[model samples]
Every structure is written in structure tokens, then in C-alpha cells.
Target chain A: MDDGISHNNNNNQILCPIKPIRCIVKLGGAAITCKNEIEKMNEESLEKVSSQLRQAMISGLSSVKICGMDWSKRPGNSEASPTVDDFSDQSLLDSDRFIVVHGAGSFGHFQASKSGVHKGGLNQPLVKAGFVATRISVTTLNLEIVRALAREGIPSIGMSPFSCGWLTCERNVASADVSMVAKAIDSGFVPVLHGDAVLDEAQDCTILSGDVIIRHLAAQLKPEYVVFLITVAAHDTTGGMVTKIWEAAMIAKLGIDVYIVKAATDDSLRALRGELKGNNVPEEWLGTVIRLLR
Target chain B: MDDGISHNNNNNQILCPIKPIRCIVKLGGAAITCKNEIEKMNEESLEKVSSQLRQAMISGLSSVKICGMDWSKRPGNSEASPTVDDFSDQSLLDSDRFIVVHGAGSFGHFQASKSGVHKGGLNQPLVKAGFVATRISVTTLNLEIVRALAREGIPSIGMSPFSCGWLTCERNVASADVSMVAKAIDSGFVPVLHGDAVLDEAQDCTILSGDVIIRHLAAQLKPEYVVFLITVAAHDTTGGMVTKIWEAAMIAKLGIDVYIVKAATDDSLRALRGELKGNNVPEEWLGTVIRLLR
Candidate 1:
């Protein structure tokens, strides 16, 4: 069951079978964690999102999930840096019924890139150390993320992808036993997960990306609304503040809509309204996503 | 696999096979979080524990594992209380090679007590609702625990025992696939787990105690050292503070020694030294635990 490479596995008995008008709000690491720097977080931005979630639950969109990652645009740091150890460990985002998945930024990329872990199938001693390093780094950040959410009164728990999900031979998520996450949501508790180094059936271990997790979760959880909040000035999308994803094929396939937004609170809240009451959201609340994956 | 329990089933290949020196640090809910209040955490106490771990790693014991649960005590609160929703999810504890399992305090006990989940084999619809409530309550506390540990620089991740470990018809931990936790420890990241409401093999869903989890982990992981950090005042051991546990029969059977401590940080650090480098710790740093189950 822990084998890593069997992508697109499904079980109707599990994976959010209820289809409750749930929403997944993704806060980009760059947006909240200051993409350019190492070991930094945007408290103000995170606080805003946190408050929005508190208010939204009151507004009736109680079944919601939030996702984010420790995404970064690093200029490279010397291992000698005093704070280098701190960069690898971070925490996650918040919301009611939050199911968070974060990317490994400064924490994971360095060791993974060094050991060439991204190339797949590591069998060497030192390379295995790299896998270990990557887990330490990303999970370190996961701790911080969970802590930040806790301070804001959002009781969030961290679940390592390697512990809960397996990667495929192609270095993609084959199967993630995310029923725990779903169960957490059903009980109204937030489940904070992050993209980390995972055990691969074919590759031994590999990186699982946050975007990939988001898509996979979107399909399985069947959240009626999805919002990707890219929280950095650097990741300004072409379609502007709100990019409505036009992945007709995906929407038709999964029966869910996605958006890349500069502002997730308003968009997700509106999307939730559109989902719960079937109300027509104002046009201004639309199109904040990068559009379809294709 | 997601079922609550299968019972005392052991698989050495997947479980802890080697007799590495590991420690189980149990942080009582009252120690770190104000058990009487809703959603309040003790930062100073948690910070002290975090630093002790950092120093412990610096002193040579690197293969350390930490386990704590969201244990709490609460006066009766009506469902009508707005804050009842906030206590379910909590945070975690500290350390590098950490595995945390917390008990449900005010968050879980209320619902589980009402649901009779502990009696095992729940079949009624209302009982099912009780299971759901327990999960929400406990997992909520898990979030806070993870967050607190993260704040203190522990790269902690959450795992729901309900999903990972199963209970027997008798409600004991049947089996828990904790390989991910071992892998996390191997990688130097702490795996934060909590007492969760789970679907059982015999019972539909039931509450799994942190103590049961600790015992199973000790047996499977085969840690040379184990400590039960009971932070609540309710559990005053007859032996007084710094009680050296002489569960000779169980120790002989399991080949592992455990201590029930009141002061987790110093006592655990001393215990780590005693296990790692064969240092004689002072006798005063013992006892700190309440009564243990015979």
C-alpha cells in the first residue's frame, strides 16, 4: 500500500465521497513567505488570509481547505550561513476544514538538486543522504508553517507526504492515502500537508510538487471551488489579478473549477457562495488563476 | 489499512526492526496548552523543551524520537458555546528525529465519552456522529500541537492514528503502519502524530490512546530508552517526582525500559545521555510522572 508508483488510483469508498461544497484555497509560498529570501515569512499576508477564513466560516462557507508551500526565489546561500538550518523547516496555511499542501523552497531544493535526486532512482549512499536531507529541510519548514497557523487560532496539523502518500515510478504521486486528510476535514479540523521528498517505487525517492498535489487533491476531494493564491509580486500572472482557469477538459472531467488569484480570501469566499447557494458571483470576483495546466 | 485496528499484529520488516536507542517524550496537554481554556497553548514551556532537544542533539544523541498527544482537561462546556469548535484541533512537540502522539483533552473526551467509542463496535447513527465529533475535536488539537512545535523550530508533521493504526475488537492498537514515521526520523525530521478517531477493524471507529501508541512504537522501534511525559496534575504517581519505572515484567518481555517523568526536558535529556553515552544521570531528575496502568 505504501508503494510509490501507481498514479491516478481511485476508491469511491474513500476520497471525499460526500461532495460537500468544499473549497481548496492555495496560498503560494512566494506570496506569504517572501519568495526571494531564505527563512522568511509574510505574517501580515498570512494573518489576512487567516482572518478571512474565520469570517468566511461565519458567512456559511465552513467546509473549506487551504494549501500553500515554502516556495522561494533564492540567490543561493553559502552553507556557512548561520540561518541556513532554519530555512529548511517551515509551517503551513489556515482555514476551516483546511487541507494544506506546501512546496519545498529553500529547504528542499538545494539538497535535492545537489544529489541529483530529481533525476530519479537513487541507490547510492550519499544520494540517500540527500533524500534524508531533503526530508529534514522541508519538514522543518512544515513545523514552522503549522506553528504559524496555530498562533492565529487555527489548529493545524502537519502530515508528511512520504508518510501519507507514495510517488509513482515517474516521480509523480501514484497514490496518497489522503483519507486521513478527508476525515480531518469532515471533522472540521485542518489537515496541513506539504510537498516533500517521497518514497518512489521506481525511483526510491523523489520530489512531490505542491501543484501536482493540488490537482490530485482537487480531483479526489471534488471540491466545487479551488483558488490558488500566488502571494508574490514576482508571480504576477498575465491575465491579471484573477485568471479563471478555462480547462474545459479538466472541468468536464473532474466537475470542479479552479482559479489563480492575487487575492484568495475574497475569491474563495465568493466561489464558496457560488457553490453553496448557487448564487451568481459578481464578475469582479472571477479569474485569478493561471488557467488550465495545458 | 485505514481501519482503526487489527490488534497486536507485528511486522518487523515494516516496524522498528533494530534496537536503536529512542525516546518517547509525552507532553501533557496541561503542560503546554492551558487545558482548562479553549485553544490556549503554553509557549514558554514548549520553548524550554525545544532548546533542551537542540542541546541534546548537540551532545551526541542524534537518533531521538519525540511522541506527545493533545491531552487536556476541561470543565463541561455546552455545544452552544462558540469556542467548542476551536479546541478539537491542537499542535505538537519538538526535536529532530521526533514522533509525537498526543491525547485528546477537552477536545476529544467530550464527544468520545458521549459516543461510547471506547466501548467498541459502534453501529448506531448517533454513535457515528459521535465518532465524527471526536475526530474533529482531537485533530483540531493535533493542528495546534504541530503548530507549536513548528514555532519552536521543530519540523514536525501530523499523522492521524485513526487512519494509520487499527484497533482490535478489544480496542487496543492492532497495527499501525508507522514506516513513514521511521523514514522521517531516519531523515532527521520529526513526525508529529496525534490520538485520532479512527475506523476500526472490529469497531467502526474508536479512540486510540497516546500510551497505547507509545507502547507499540517502543516495541516496534525497539528503542533503548522510553519516557512517558505526563504533564497533567491529575496523574500524580505514588512514587513522587523522578520515579524510575521498574515494570520488570514488561521490561523483560519487551527488552526496553521506560520512565514516567514530570519534568520532560531535563529528565528526557538526562535519559538520552544515559542511553546514548552511558552517563549516570542524577536520581533527582526522575519521577515526575503520575500513576501508570498496571
Candidate 2:
């Protein structure tokens, strides 16, 4: 009745008994804004975040995956141009074996909304202006991010849901191959993904949230840990807290050991380090989720 | 006696004459701004000029060299950031055999004037500011130019007079090891040089012009032909046509043929058909100049 959730010696199919925890750290936009103030993004805070990530990777963590919302300030009406410093966050992101997925917030949301796509809570926009804008924004952002990562000597590959032929309707991604993700991980390369809308056979077109993608990946791969490096703490309500709470709830319900951590903060970031040091997550979740398979 | 110029006809002494002309076109800043009108740096006109150069090269006329100034709107300021498009002239300058040497007009001049390191004239207060500004600007400009060339699949090496230990005094290069320039050309690579003022052995520092460098080179190599593509025709202000210019004069005196030709005009550019046309200068003069062995 344990439903393969609990540890058993007979389930030798598991790669490692002391499953090396491979984590996917989701850094919420709210947390980024909270630590550095939403008014202006600070380089110091970014560096602090990068340093911590680097430490986590250097400590022999099986794998660390980082995801965040695209907080670039360029107006979405025109094509967004991310500066070289935009990817400065990679200083930490490149420290270990990690994959990154980002959300389109300031970069694509306004354009999508203006185009009358991703609006009305319905999926019927004939032209799909929102989708086209989102795709272009994501593509540009991905290129910049890839260049930054490469400059940092990290082998990173950009994978788009659209490129993979994943179809979606509204703001939801119906399906994806996911095999590409696995392949990138297997090849020691960091695969970068972003929250993007794609054509879906079942639902027309959908927006695939980074949070949802991480959950689906965890459910399948069952990584050792799932670290949510949001801009705010788990209980913060400044903005987007409702969505964070909902995501945390769903992840907890899935029975996957989850940690809602804040990036580069005095409190939560310290807690993140302590959690990794103490190895506090349940043994069952650790065994199934964390695998040190490199 | 023609004792100053040395010509060794031995085949081994010949430094790959038949080894495709890796000519580095050093376009003068005057050509970019036509001396009389800095505001008239026309892209369309320059484009035509570039087209003509390309045609000449394609017709087995050896390689064409171009200066970054040929594409710039203003003479480089020694104190500003170097723009990438400032070297757009290189688009046509590029080929399997071409080399380029660009000038730091505004970038270098601004620095020199501010620092009071006036290579041409003494302006104490201005020179003080110019020194620091020019140092920073030249480095910045050179880095940008190198990056731009690399982006276009042209590997360019930047050598600064200061870094190379070549100083200038009173508008003259005091001393320099010409080996660097020779090596770059001999190895089939593009060596980029710029107008710079260096600490001079005699006068403290001097302005070194690209034209002067080209003149010295003609004297050294005794190439079959020495062509100077200037903004204006070879005419003295006294209404006397100088069939023989300074560099051309020097080369001709050394018994080497020389040709001073203006860049193609708009009309000439339109009529260009990729033919190998000869400069109107007499054949005797042309033959005495070094020919592109390729």
C-alpha cells in the first residue's frame, strides 16, 4: 500500500540507496524583488545569490536546478534587449551541474496582455498575438542567457517547448517530450527552459508555467530535493504570494519533500544552507527523489 | 646613391610575394570626414566605396584593407565608448586575404586633447584630461573593434603603441619594432593598428599617423605597387596636381612604382562591373610599384 513511496530493499531498480539529492530550485520573482526591492535590481544581491548557489554546487550536491521569472525591465511592446549584465545571475547558476527554467514576467506579460492573448481566462484568440510575442521574447531572452552561460564556461543549451512541439491552450502546457530534458542532463549540459506558450492539440495553445514544469519533472524523476528560491519567504504576501502558497501546497501534497527557500536573504537563504547540511527531508522522499546519478 | 633602400632579389629573401596580398587597408580619418565637412560622413557613399574595394579584390587585385574610420560618423573621440558599427566598413574589407588597420580618431583625439599629451599641439589643461581619457578610450575602442571583427568571422589582433613600447614625440613615432607588423602580415593574419600618441624618446610623446606608417612600410618592402586611397585627389593647394604624393613620392624616389587614387565615387560605384581596371597613373610608375603577386 506504500505505492512505491517508501524505501524497500527489493526495489533494487532505484539507482542509489542513499539517493543523491538532485534539486530543482525555483527562485520566485517575489523573492528577488523582496531582497533587492522591486524598485531597482541590485548587483550585490545577485552576486550574493550566485555565491550561495556556487557553494551548494561545490559541496558535491548531485545537481542543482535554478529557475526564475524573467524580470528584465524592457517594455514588452517592442523587442526586449537584455544587457550582458542581465545574465550576471549565471555566476552562481554556472557553479554546479544545473538546469535553469525562467518565467516571462516583465519581458512578455505586457505585450501578451496588450495583444489580447492570455486574457479573459479563455483560449480563443484567432491571431495568437500573445503567443507570438511570448515566443519572441523567450527566444531573445534564452539567447542572451545562453551567451552569458557560455561566457562563464558553462555548457548550456536552450530548449523551447515550441521547438519540442509541446502544445498548449491558454496558459497551460498540455504535453512535452521531456526526453530532451533528460538527454541534456545525461550529457552533463545545463538545459535552459522558460515559461512559454505553445500550440497544443488538445487545448489549442497554452502557457507553461516554470513551477508546473518543475513539479512534473519531479514527479517523474523524483529528485532528492525541490528548492523554491522565490523572491519572498513562504509566508510573504507582498505580491504573487497567493500563487506561491498554492504551488507549495500542491508540491507538499504530491508527497515530494519540498523546501520553499528565498534566494540571497538573511533568513531563508541561511535556512536553505542549514537544510542541506542537516539532511532533514524524510528518508522515503530522499530515497525516491534524490539520485546521485550525475 | 640609392643607399637608403635595400632590395635583395634572392628568392629566399623574398617574404612570400606570391603568397596572396594580405594588404591591411588603413583608411585615414580625413577620408571619413573629407576634412572640410565632418557632418558629411555618408553611409551610402561609403557603401559604394566599400563595393568598389570588394570588386577590386574579387578581380584578383590582391586583398583590400580598410580602416574603421571609413565607416564612422565622426573621427573617433579618445574619451567615448567605441561602437560596433563603427567598423561596418570591414564587412567589405573581409575576404580570405584582406587585412585591416583602423584609426582611433575621436576616441584617441579626445584623450590626447584632454590629457594635454598633445602629440600635435600643446594644450596643458586639455592634455591632462586627454591622457587618462585617451588611455581608457583607446583600450575600450580596440576591444570593441576586435570583438566586432571576430563576430564577423575575421580574427583581428590589436596592438597598441603604448603596450608595444612604441612612443611618439611631436607628431612622430619616435621608435617602434616593425617586426610585429611584419609578422602579422607574413603569417596571413590581420594586424590592426590605430593612430596613437606614445611617450617619445626625444620629445616626450608624439602623434603617429597611419599614413606615416604606410610610408615607412613602402620604403621597407618595396612592394610592386603602393596605392593610397585618400579622400581627395593628389593635388596641392596651389592648383598644382601632385602626380607624385608624399608616400608616392618616397616610393617613386626609391625606384618603386606608386599610385595615389581616390575611392570610387557614387557614379563609378554604380558602373562597377568587377573588372580589373588600372589606375590612370603611367605604366612605368605602376610597374615600379610592388604588384600583388597573387
Candidate 3:
């Protein structure tokens, strides 16, 4: 009669809670790749973003260490950057606990679309070939991004969905086990995930979009903020900016703020640093934000 | 005071049990790569092994589907292959439910040894660089193996220990959460794991050897048997054949038989097909088996 749902809830209640996740960052595939060129990475942009991430983590999380704050709950939007007084009081609640999810722009989209892999039919050899090709491409990028982050002293690990039982039903996410991601974060490592080709219940196999992954993580992890570092290209694959914005809006309904900023820009760093507001962006910062209205 | 160990036991009990694992196969790094050369894979050997795996699965496990056997426990060493009458009785207790774990071989040894990454000191930037280089080399090879297996219609998923919660303390495995591996197996995927560099509590980090991993998995999963597809070379940075045999001997103490066979050989295929025996090697069979002397 329980159907195991209540059993899982009972399981969760008894376990020690993980570090409160502060942000879920989405890196658009177009932002880090030469979209028109097949399998070409935008190295300069990637390096810039990595450096910014390092800076953001140091500035944001250092305060928590200095203050030795008990981060049980996420801070409200009203909270400002920590000051010396805040550190002394030890009430300042902020930490750079975030997960990075990236897209598979030029890395995988070509093979996926060409083979019609998104539709899924594993019996067909072409579809299977496409799945392998797509995974190789996307996982290559995931490892590259993880290596770049590691160079910046970030303990980043690549977690591929297909390798971790992430499944979809007719292009919709049917089941995604985020327990490993949660454990990775709890053990003091940044988890880097990517869009991947996964098995489907109905179609046999299909593409599991990174946008869908972000939304699912937001719902499950309840991060305080979600950041989208994207660059829209004229010719794009995998639904481009429209799908990202739509996903962002859906996540906003959960009362978490969402920032859409161009990658490698100061605006991206600003969003990461918790500076840019939903409706009050200055001319200098080029970005948009989504927030739920009370 | 409870250390939450009992709580995890309670959590596991409610979850659905996975299929009984018939085997845990180890593809030695030396067997799959040109150990003398840095970062080179032996493509021919890899292809042969992959094809053999496909054959073994089809031949050994196909009867289970036809007989519709309920596999609650692994078959004992005395049981032979299923027969026609066995199928009619619907009491065949054999299935090809197995997991693959490979080694780094020529892939990661050079970088890992060059930087002395086996002894960890994370503060040293050089150590971090070595970790990155080592991961790139090994993960590159892991992807190649996964792709090879995929080509053979084996649903292989590469699960890196570092990406999950596998940790070591002073080079001994302190904690390894095989929950993801179990989930992958339950969901009908052959989880492909590899020797990896992991975080160490005593040392800043250390290499978690494939030999150690095999022992841990055998102790935890209690598979019916284990097969080591290995090649003993003149030099091995990670203890070579001696360590493998010691690990196999240790596993044998748990009532699980282990076979040490030459990679890509007919004996290797026979070992996988459950044909080889301990201390009774035929002239054609080029392998050694370690079995507890009950």
C-alpha cells in the first residue's frame, strides 16, 4: 500500500541534512563552444568563466568560514554581503555551495539531431551509434570543464546522467537519481553535470536536456538561487535560449530567484556574487532575472 | 551513540532488491593498454574482449529468459551450465548479471607516478595538476572502453569512484558508497568502474587501486565469482600481478572463486563462460583459479 514513496520520505527524515545548496548555475552550450563549428570549444570564454567562478567562491564562501556560521537555512533576499561585524556576531548565513550544469552545444547536438536520437529507438543501430557519439562529445566537454575548474583549485567532479540512472519517458524526465550529486556536495566537492543521451521507458532512448536537469535539481535540492550564463547564437540547436528562459520561469515559481546573464561577462560574475537584482539591473550589467511575485 | 550506520541499514531494507550478480570482471590495465607506452590503448585486445563479453552474455544468460527463472541467489561453483531438462523444470539459477571494472594501465600511471600523487598533499599545486592529468588520461580510456562495450550492444556506463563518494584514508579505502553502482545494476546497466584517484583523509589524496576495489566489491556484493583478465609485465607502477593475486586470494577467503586469465585469450572466454576450475587447468586453458579449500 505504501508504494515506497512514504518509505523514501521516512528514509530522508532520518539522514543528516547536506550543506544548504546556495546556487544552481547553468552554463549554456553556446557560451562555451563555437556553435557553428563542430566540436570546437570557446577556450578563452571557458578560462574566463573558470577564473570568475574561483573568485566568486573565494569571496562568497570565505565569509562563511570566517564567521563560522551555522548554515541551516538559506538567507532571504534582504540579506547583504557579510561585514566585519557580521563575522563577529556569527549570524551571517551565506556560502558558495553550488552545482554547475552545462549544455552540449557543438559537442553533441550535431550527432544527436543527425541520428534523430532525441526521438529514441534503440533497436535501430544508427540511433545507438548516435547515443555513443553524443555521450563521447558531451562527456568530453564535461571533463574539460571539470579540469578547468580543478586548475582553479575547485574540487569539481563530472557526473554523467546516462551513467547514473537518469531516465526519461517520451522526452520527459521519468526518473533522475540525484543522491550521488547530493553526496558529492555534502563531501565538499563541486558536481558538474551535463545534458546526455539516456534510456527512455517508452521510446527505448532519448536526450535528457540539461535545462530539464536544472529544473529537477532546483525542485529537489531547493537551492537559494539559479544562474544561467548563456550566449544566444543566430543558428542554434537543441531549442537554444527560448527553452532556457522557459525553464528558468518554471523554476522561479518555486520562489527561487533566477538570473540569466551572458557568459564571460562581468554580469555573469555579478550574478554569481549575488549582486544583480531581479528587476533592477544597471546599464553596465547585461542580464535578465525571474522572480516569483508574492 | 549511533553513528548512523544502523539508519542506513534500515533505509536499504525498504528498497527493492537488485538482480543477483553472477560475476564481477576486472580488465587489468596492462591487458588493455601498452603498459610501456604512455597513454596508449591496445585496441585489438580491447575489441576482442568486448566481443567475447557479448558472446558470454548471450550464451550464459539467454537460458534465464527462456526458463523465466527467479534469480534470488547466485549459483554455487558446483552447478554446471543449464540443460534442456533444466529449462523445463524452470529451476535454472543462472544469469549474466555482472559488472565490469577496468584499470588505468598505461593511461594514468605515468602522470600519477611522475607527480607522486599516490602520497597526497593538496596544498601543492603540482599535486592538483597531476590529479587533473591523471583523471584526463584514465577517463579518456574509460570512455573508449565504454564506447567499445556499447558497440557490442552492452549497456556499459562508466562510473568513476571520484565522481561518486568513494574515499580512502592513507591509501586504504575508508568509505565507498556502492549505492549508485547497485542502482545502475538494478536498472539493467553494466556499471563500468575503473581505478581512480580519490580524496584521502590522512594524506590529502591517494590513488585507490583497482585491486583494492575488487576486494571491496566482492566483500560487499558477494558475487558468485570474479574474473581477472590480466597480463603480467616487466614493470607495473601499481604492484603488478603480485597485488592482483593477493587481492584474488583475499576474495577467495569469502567463498567467492576468482579466475586469473590472460586477456583476449580463449581461456578468458572460457573463464567468463564458467568453464575453468581451480587446480584442474586443462592443457588448452591458460589461467589460474583461486578457490577456498573447503
- Per-candidate DockQ values are 0.05, 0.01, 0.11
Q: What shift in Å separates residue A43 of candidate 2 from its native position after superposition?
A: 4.2
Q: Write the per-residue lDDT of candidate 1 for residues B1-294, one digit (tens) a residue.
A: 332222232312354522243565555555555556444556576666655654554343344332221111112422231121232232222233545666664456655665566665434433444454455556566656665554334555565665453344456666566665675565445566666666565655666666566666766676655555556475422222332234322432575555555544566666544442233345576553322243
Task: Show the colliding residue pairs in model 3.
Answer: none
* Tens-digit lDDT track of model 3 for A10-73: 2232222366787889888988888877778898989899878867765644444332111111
> What is the docking quality class of candidate 2?
incorrect
lDDT of 2 at B244: 29
lDDT string for model 2 (B42-129, tens) is 3443444555545543454334342222111122434232233333333333233444444443345543543345543222323322
What is residue B241's positional error in candidate 3, in angstroms? 3.1
Q: Which ten residues in a row have the lowest lDDT in candidate 3 chain A?
A: A66-75
Model 1 stretches with alpha carbons more than 4 Å out: A1-5, A8-21, A60-98, A104-157, A165-168, A232-252, A264-268, A275-294, B1-175, B182-210, B219-294
Candidate 2 residue lDDT tens string, A135-191: 444444444444333323344455555543344434444344454455345434456
Better of 2 and 3 by TM-score: 3
Docking class of 3: incorrect
**Least well predicted 10-residue stretch by lDDT in candidate 1 chain B:** B66-75
TM-score of 3: 0.74
Model 3 per-residue lDDT tens digits across residues B1-294: 121122253223222225567788999898888877666779899989987886776565443433211111112424232233533433322225778999998887776876667989655544544565577667878887877776565656678877655678878887775655665565455778899887787886889888898898888777878999987577666786788789999999999989998888888998887666445567777778899998
Q: Per-residue error at A120 for model 3, in Å? A: 5.6
Ranking by DockQ: 3, 1, 2
